[model samples]
Target: MKKIFIVFVGLCLLIQSRAIADEGMWLPSLIHKLNIGEMQKMGLELSADEIYSINNSSLKDAIVALDRGSCTGELISSEGLILTNHHCGFDEIQTHSSVDHDYLQDGFWAKTKEEELPNPGKTVSFLVRVENVTDQIVADLTDEMPFAERNASIQRKSFEIQKEATEDTHYDARVQSLLEGNRYYLFVYETFRDVRLVGAPPKSIGKFGGDTDNWMWPRHTGDFSLFRVYCGPDGKPASYSEDNIPFQPRHHLPISLKGYDKDDFAMVMGYPGSTNRYKSSFGIDYTMNETNEARINARAKKLEIMKRYMGSSQKARIQYASKHARSSNYYKYSIGQNKGLSALQVIEKKKNIEQEFATWANASEERKAKYGKALELIESAYENTQDESAYEYLVETMVRGPEIFYFSYGAKGLYEALKQDNQERVKTNAEQLKTELDDFFKDYNANTDAKVAAALMEVFNNNVTPPYQPRFFNEIKYKYKGDFDAYVQKMFDKTLFAHRAELEEFLNNPKLKTLEKDRAFQSALDIFDLMSVLGSKMRETKADLLTGRRLFVAGMMEMYNDKKFYPDANSTMRLTYGTVGDYIPRDGVHYSYFTTLKGYIEKEIPGDDEFDVPGKLKELYEAKDYGQYADADGTLHTCFTTNNDITGGNSGSPVINGNGELIGVAFDGNWEAMSGDIAFEPELQKCINVDIRFVLWTIDKFAGATNLIDEMTIVK
Candidate 1:
């Protein structure tokens, strides 16, 4: 049975591999020559060798590299140029842009090589390929090993593999687990340390419709950016150097000129964060739908308050910039998930999954016994944490949240992170504060005092000892005559407005040595110190909460379900593939992959600030310069749709053909896929890709990046 299971998984992997290999749609080639012939027969312009040749692994590098959260660029040029999304590179560009060079407001341009702007410390990564280590991992995680012990064993193995593979090479690799505890793979990646900002379109052109139009179809946003990766003299990763050369690639995608028609197969090759296809009806139905609403609402309130302050005060804007982005991300996902749940008819799906479980579990005495333990474990965790865990969770959240506004994983695995952990995360007390709060002031933002104070106070009151005392209580008392509110208010009214200089002043002040001595602050800092090593403690606590419940919910699903179930998300890489298709959201509403320029103009109202499309794009629309691009909207005659499995990290993934030519970048998934976290609806699930033609026209006519566009096979 196990052999059959392994073979089944392998066959599925082979099918997918062949779907991409040499661009054959369905048939498997018997030889390399046959494969090449089949690829060309299927309009697969690029060969398997060509595809593999361009898959260089030297993109992830920089002096201070951004974490996985940021959409990274891939070098398409040997002359040191890269391509990424506009939003991903916005901050660095904004930092260098000014009133005279207002890249943020009007966008930027560099007609010649000398015109490109150098970003002091930006990097890009290229993934070479992946290999399996399931045998080694499964052997190490034998039945006698506990989950923690199993995880540790895997980690040790991963380090060994990474060191071996990356030695004598300026590259990095890591081990990854798949199918919960079923499979494992190792990915090898090469990074380019020196990357520079090239050009961006103005907000008017780039972010035209802004947040309101986000996630909506038939959109007209020029969402693209240009960058270049540079390598040092010895042909290796290095810090920014004037003499650095543009990286040469083993393979580079030639841009496709004739855009895709409907029903064309497309695949996204990149990292995807998580998917909850294996979640129980219990969590997806009861917990996620109900609990996520409250969590989302709480964050919505925080965002509203922060936005109000940000709109009025520049100091507040800069200080809480990270906070707003973090909160907004939650807001976006929450709202999208809610929409997906509604679209999926979650309440109904919940009933269906439950009915199936009750029938299967009660089928026989043997069935009931089989599911009992798994069910019990999940119920226990829910009972313990449903109400009481939020406080501690919030404290833990506070310690990690702000630090990861722009960073993914909140910068886990830092040098001092593990040294500060408590032996056990059993009791929520001074130990948590000491380990988690140790780094609080080290990276604290002084501006946006109201929000920071409010967040801390909430965490303190809900999770800390005896509840209800501000951080740095003693310091505020000594510094401002015993009024925490007054001290916060003083910080808000006086200190925050002059944010940058004032923060330095507060940290450096001799009299306010109180910064380090503050009791509440110290407590929070201690917890920060221990956050890394406490993963096991937290995971154990978590296991106790959900999947551990064998007798309650998880058991029945595990024992009797038709498909094998994996646990809920733990930030792992997963691959979900399906057909290229569209979905009907309601009785009438539909979406498409290609949204025409004419359709965007049709939706526009004259004299409206937001509705205005640049005159040039409008002219191109009037002339119907689509080349071969088609309108996706059947009813509105505007846009098109596709089905490519994607999520957060897939935002900037390049959508490619069997020939390995760039089609369009995968940006957003449709509403159906939003339910993807809890339920992988193969029927309705689809991904939204911005067609390559829209990108081509924007570059050639709009941004006049004609030279860059000319590098590709623009068939026209």
Candidate 2:
């Protein structure tokens, strides 16, 4: 009863001191107790139970976590049609593209369901429910327990609980810690394995401003794609099969054609990937100096090499499109994040907060004993940035930069089987490698990867110290006379993994001697070995860092008992509500809430890769052929901005209106708010969404994909 009273007081305090309406990403299950009345006051027409319910169909059933939270998608039809950002489905689109049929350059639409393309290993998970499991997880833990031991205990208890919840069911379950381990919640999901591509616009429309205008406002990108989910006869999750039928979902969002006005109510719900709003000043410094710096330096060189190769031929462009996009996206993000952090003075603000908290802690002996040393521990852990810097560089330059090294590492299983002289195991592993070869080599260019390897190797050598460098560097220095290009050329020429035919021949008749002499395989082993060593060296510091963070968060919750607090995002299902509004990004510079098709036409460059306007799209724009998809103003609005909080995994989240109708599809965040993951700037942070009407316009008028549009539930 005493504990219950404390919990109730906490709730009351949170409600009394709620921050700006746009500042939180809230869990759906707790909305009834914590936020429903506030949300209703802000113009929400639906009840909490209508948004999330365990016994009845609700909006939760219509949301999906594509590939388990890499991105979000929404169900638009009862036949399981999915609407997500084109970038979210880029891998599949690129995989099916070739010189003869370049879907990325030209749009693709399935005239019939039979023509819809299948993608292996892709999944879409629907959230079943969420339950607070704090007591079950931390009831037995004590303050005296070591951090490692406490974590192990939590993991064991969580596993037991998850097993019990998911036993005899096809649903998958996870127990995620929240508020820096001060809270815990269980999330169960029903995952479907067979998701297929239904339609996509050409790059000229879908990726319209490309990297140049990625995080900028007044966006004109038609960043949306269509997909469908399939299930077995029992309507359960199943592998891809010819006889599978389109899934029948319990609920789907009704698209709203009526356009929104400024300050109209808006909300977004999706799986936000991660954030560090409660991070210490020391942590922010480390991110700017070490992590972001390394990524920027390494990816700049790698992207340059890829761009040169991609411009060589049509096949080359199709092959490297997805890889280049993935690398360049974060490369630009890191640059923008550094600029925002400095402009916002985030580190200084964090220091002021820490000083205030320290003063509060020292006022009482009891508080001092419980919360003291939190900042000291955090500072000490981050004091030595060398090891962490080296590790970050190694990861960016070696592990992620070069494809050949990691691809060659896939044969480790076959190597182990051969060493054991297990013929059956060897046969199994060999066949597995053979199966993966087609996919890997289909997109891989040996010359391109070899160039990438040389550039990235030079980056690692220049940035990382001698002691932290991978052992393969010794071979480069002595055997290859310190020329990265020479070393990479020799390795590519000699390795069987570089080409499909050579690797297939070796797999057909495997031998231990041939594998042992392979230069690429040996280098892969050394690279991973160094990674393990670096990881082990950081374990103690990592443990201390986590302990300090957890205690600090707990102390802050008690210190500011009247303040509302939200947990950091960790790829969990969350809902954030706000309004469709514009803002002053800088003094004397006002930005509008939305952009129009006229801006897209004005930005077009003839024959340019990023801004090239499709001839058919130009014809329609010249004719003003927007049809019924245009707004009341008789113009097509391309994108709009909202104040709702979101992050990386919210890429394709639905933007819903007060009446619970889909208004837009979220795709990016404004440039001025790149530091939002650490500290939200309500005045500058904006959720950039592609207008739903523009999505419909591109489908019906631009592509004439009426069959695809016919299945949707549109509200005009």
Candidate 3:
């Protein structure tokens, strides 16, 4: 009876706190229908006026919006200090980490601004607000308009609205239309054209168990990184300026000096990538069944291949971390998602929905008009381009593309075309970039080239491309009588012009490089050249297939405006609202809203790379003096869970409350939702975030950067 009462009371508190979190802003249908001031019921204790005042005043100017060269971020300080998740900044930061100074392994910290790392081509964009123009947008699109024309019309309308909304505003902004032709939202933004790194934990600490712990339960990793935003001489936005000044945001979050307890009212505001809880069953099935299995299987194989080269070469390690990071990410996320699909019964649910939709529509003419032809439409699409489309991704991503694909959607052809397009747009940049290419090639990977080639050869032989009778293959055959390993080796490095040294050394080695110098590598380079052509074909087909399917769904979905879709999770700015609470992930298996400092200690296998705690964190826990925010567990926990909706692109979102106070920084979600690309399991899935309190604790206790903490109002 007593336990029941406690749970009942706890439920009430959770409801109240969730209400209090959104003190003023209107709640989207996703979070608990919360209004701005509703969070007080959840133990916020503060009145709506107080919360609104805080949102409108406190830190309003303190939190400067940050763009991680792409996504949005908030400046958490007055001195150009920035805060974002470790994953968001990993790419640029990784470029600077190496064997001698492996920051990813240990994490990066700058004692002062001068020591902060500089990353070229990175940016931070600040958002102002978003407005809806749905009715106006829909009225203009005629049924007669061609798909191309309709899209143009929508773009013009959206662009105009964006221009007007951001007119004369110092910040940058854009308008994105969601659900094809159904709705539109204009986002006003403040862009800091040049952003630089401030600090970051080592990869061990930032990424912790690397990909092993990503999006899992009972996770104990700190996936956070730090950076600073910069602008031009006149305190304006500019691109890559040495003469830039540290940008000071209008409002910065006052690091909560008074920590949080279990039911604190909170919310997160940042661009969330995407959530497909509302997708069709066919979409769900393809992902949960075929796509998931195929992708995970391929990734597992690719990892084995990558390990071979990465272990053998340091240069290979450096060049491929980005690719490794991407594949590892997919591998981890996919497996987790596969687990989620089963656990959440995503496949069954998809089948059920498909059946239900059909049964519901069989009797009604209106219903039939609405979606009765799903099977016919779907089958036609599959027949029209399945093989060609599959080949597109294969050609673009796996074959004729860099095995070490970076920023190439598994398609090197498309990447090159885009690269060319960008280069053409900047002729001067093309000239300057020519100078950078030599250095890029000098640092290019022999091992990576081999690995990618091997992967490509595997794809070509196994799939679309035929087994060719190239000399590279013959070299392997001659060397090892057709042993696959020997074959792989020859294909990887069997240069026709075997000139390891200069041309003079290989005198009659009429092998290609015999008479030529470094030109011996030309055979491989020549094939690399054809990448653009292959990429172009792949791009067109991929667009025709992926886009066609997506657009059809979007077109079908144009009628369902009750829910709003943000976009394809393009790593942009977004906001997710939820309260602080925990739930039972499975039967009788409860997950606390918060974990503790002691939890970290218990998990630490002292010196075990996966569980090693930083000295500062160890000291704090050893002291056992958690300030106001420590949970009943007696440990200061950095991570927490919530019921807020999210997906891959939401990796670094900031979780906030009704008053818009950031309670946590978003990173990953529970694996059960990995099918989230198509299904949503509200009961079992939760978003994992780095608590705001942890961010504060790191700044004050560990990093010893107290200057940032003192800048915020430490509310109790």
Candidate 4:
């Protein structure tokens, strides 16, 4: 009751305050109680129930969580025409692509429903309901309870509640903590598995400007892909089958060709992955120096090696396209975030806020009792875990960096199965491993991986101390004579995992001794053994850090009742609204809210993969075939900017107008605000979206996929 009262009062205060432009990733279920009045004042034409309703068809019906929340997508037609970002579907596209067909380079368009490509394991989910369960969860907790005990009780209660709620349904339920465990909510979702690819533009359009313009504004990338949801004839979730039919959605979004103007109301609803808006200054410092820095450095090396191979071979280019993009996207983002953290003086700002909070806490004995030790605990935890930087490097370089080493880690399951001496289970596991390896090797290049292994191994040796070095390094020093390159070459030569034929032969003649002697497998075992030792040593400090953060967050909320607060994103569906506006990132640098086809043409560099404009697109531009998708000024809008709060998983989220009509697809955030995941910069943060009109133009005119265009409800 106390926790509920605090949240309720917070909501009342939030409703009375003037709203900031790009501040929150709000829960949709609480909109009427927390945001509707302000939203209506900002030009919203729909009621709260119209946006989110469990018992009726509403805007929430159109939205789907792609692949259980790696990204977001929307139903654009009654027959389940799903629209999501190209990168979100990059894996599926790559899996289906071949050297001869090259769907990635040439694109694919299913003229008929029968031609749509089936994607196994791919799924899209819709939120069925969000229920407040704070009172129920806290009913068993007391203020004097120990942290571990309280956490255990909460988890036990949440499991019981979720199990009971989802007892007989196909729906999935998760109990997520809000306000850092002070509040709680249960989100229920209905997931569909039989999703199929319908259409995609070539990389020349879909990934225009490629890595060079990934998180940049004034962009022209047509980063959209088409998929469809299929279900059983009875209209329930079903496995992939030829017998499955396209799902008839309860509601689908009407795309508005009525383009938005600057300052026009905009709202985005999607699963935002994460944000640490309440992070302490010490935590921010740790992220800047240790986590992000290690990631950026490690990924940079891998990207360079991948780019070298990709640049040389057309096959390698297609194979590693998605891999390179994924690595580079965050590599650049980390660099930008470090710069933003420094340039924005975020640490100083955080310190000032901490000082203010401390002053207030010390002013009252009760406040001091609650919050006096929060910041101290956070600082102590950070200090105790200062040595984690080396571990982070090991994780980034040894575990996540080298392709061969990572692949070898999978052998642990096989090793365990072999020990069981169950011949039937062994064969079953071998076949399963073969299937996984087939998928892995489909886009794998051994030459590139060998280079990556050598480089990253050397980096690990140089950065980490002698005591911390994995046991395998001693082999390189003693047996290989300190030659990592030679060792890697021999491993690739002897390891059956490197080649399918060799692996198939080994699987047929199963032997535990062979795996034990294998250099690649041995290295994986050494790393795993060493990591386990180090992980145990670090566990206590990590537990302290988590507890400190939870307490610190609670303290802030309790002490600062005047300021409105929103919880950090945790890969749950949220709604954020603002306006279609631009910002001056710095002095003397004002950017427009929208970009047009002309800017795209001017930026094109022929024969260059990153900025190459397809000959057909160039011809279209020359002929001014803007069609009905163009603005009144006769310019085709490519992408636009909005000061809407969003993050990584918000990719492919529908950027809707006040009328609940899809106007654009949110794809990227401005580079200037890369630090937004840690701290929201209301003035600088902007959500970059691909104009829905451009998506339509590419489908109807450029791709000649009028059948797709005919299915959607297009509002002029």
**TM-score of every prediction relative to native:** 0.73, 0.97, 0.76, 0.96
**Regions more than 4 Å wrong, model 4:** 1-19
Model 1 agreement with the true structure over 515-568: per-residue lDDT tens digits: 233333343454454343444444655654433433333343454345333333
Candidate scoring better on TM-score of 1 and 4 = 4
Structural RMSD, model 2: 3.7
Q: Each candidate: what lDDT?
A: 0.52, 0.90, 0.55, 0.86
Q: Pairing residues by index, what is the TM-score of model 4? A: 0.96
Candidate with maximal TM-score:
2
Q: Write the per-residue lDDT of candidate 2 for residues 512-541, one digit (tens) a residue.
A: 887899989989988988988989888869
Number of the top lDDT candidate = 2
lDDT of model number 3: 0.55
Model 4 pairs in collision: none
Instruction: For candidate 4, write residues 1-716 as lDDT tens digits.
Output: 55444333321212124546357889999888888988999989999999999999999989999999999999999899999999999988888888897898988999999999999999999999999999999998886788779889999999988998899988889999987677899999999999999999999899998888988878999999999999999999999988999999889999999899998999999999988877889989999988988888788889999999998977888899888888888889999999988877888777766776678778999978876777887787788553476688788888888777778778777788888877787787777777887788888988888898888888777777778888888889999998999999998887877887888888887788888888888888888787777787777676567766777677777765666567778888899999998889888999999999999899989889888888898899999998899987789999999988899899999999999999999999998988888777777889999999999999998999999999999998
Residue 80: error of model 1 in Å? Answer: 5.0
Alpha-carbon error at 366 in model 4, in Å? 1.6
Tens digit of lDDT per residue, candidate 3, span 1-716? Answer: 56434322221111223222321112132222334334444444434333222235432233333443233355666666777788778777777876777676666777776777787667666544446677766678764565566667778887777777777767566666554334566656566667777777765567766666777766666777788887787777888766778876666665553445555656555555554543454555556555555566556666777666766755566555656777777777767777876766655554554454456556678757655665444434444333443444354334434432221121223224344555443344324434444334433555555555556445443433323223344454566664544454553344322222322232222232221222224334434444554455444434234333444445334433343333434334433445566777667787787765666667766665456777767777778656665644555777888766566655666666545556677777776566555554445557788877776676666767665566555666
